[model samples]
Target: MKNLLIIILAALLYTIATGNTAAQEMGDKEKMKIFTNWIGRWEGEGSMQMGPGEPRKSKVDERVEAKLDGMVLLVEGVGKAQDASKQEIVVHHALAVLSYDKNTEQYKFRSYLKDGRSTDAWIKPTGENTFQWGFDIPGRGKTRYSIVLDPVKKTWDETGEFSQDGNTWMKFFSMHLTKTE
Candidate 1:
């Protein structure tokens, strides 16, 4: 009976040590579910300041999918607009991967643009249906981006802003999108 008690105590101690690890893994998966609402094909329209000129009208389309068993989000976006001459269609494409970093307790966003520009940003949830992500630009300012999901309206709104003082923000662009899939 003493031997059986010793074996049971050892098993109990092992479970106590390993159970927390399992719980943490489950927590990570649950945290990733915050982005499930964004998984779909979306279409939208917006305007952007391409240069020193006025904001030009643009048509935008995006596709977001949950990959790696819902551990990562893959996003593809395309924007098209008529050039100033109105004789050609200007197109821009961007791809992004968003994933959670368990070690840092933050979401990491990596994006690549057709113009060969790439950026890495840290993401965090700001509201029940909203998340904000961005990075600091040296010598310029900090650029931040946000996405708000409205499930009731089946719509998504995204915006970008720049802050010269890290407090006063100036809006740069915004897009309103409707879920197609």
Candidate 2:
């Protein structure tokens, strides 16, 4: 009876240890939950500097969704603004995917633009409700975008900054959105 009790205790201890290890091994799905508040439809206005000229204003729409069994977030955005003749035209259109890489233990952001410009960048979670993503341009400069979602107010604010010397930054873009759904 004493030997049997010892074996049972050892088995229980081993099971508990393995269970804790498994629980602590976070997967991609768990990491993706950081974007939960961003999973919705949003509409608002945005502006971006096109040149040394003034920034153009436009109405923007964003749809964020969870795909691949919640392992990735698919983000689609469209911006419409009036042309010189006051005709509504597409100012910007983009599709992006956000995913957490288990191997790298980091988030990846890939964006596709209407102008055939695409970028594969890194995304860092700044807080429970914020994410910043960007990439470095070899000869030009680096551009970074930061997005903050206010769950209480159901608002999303994003800003874009560019740096040429890795120190001084210029704010070139901004978007203010309200959750529509």
- On lDDT, the candidate that comes out on top is 2
Off by over 4 Å in 1: 1-22, 50-52, 84-90
lDDT by residue (tens digit), candidate 1, 36-77 = 898999998977664487786688889999988788899999
Estimate, for each residue in 75-176, the C-alpha lDDT of model 2 and write its tens digit: 999999999899999989999999887677888899999999999998888977988889998899999999999999999999999999889999999999
lDDT score for candidate 1 against the true structure: 0.88
Every model's TM-score: 0.83, 0.84
Clashes of each: 0, 0
Q: What lDDT score is found at residue 98 in candidate 2?
A: 92
TM-score of 2: 0.84
TM-score of 1: 0.83
Query: Model 2, poorest ten-residue lDDT window?
Result: 20-29
- The alpha-carbon root-mean-square deviation between model 1 and the true structure, to one decimal in Å, is 3.1
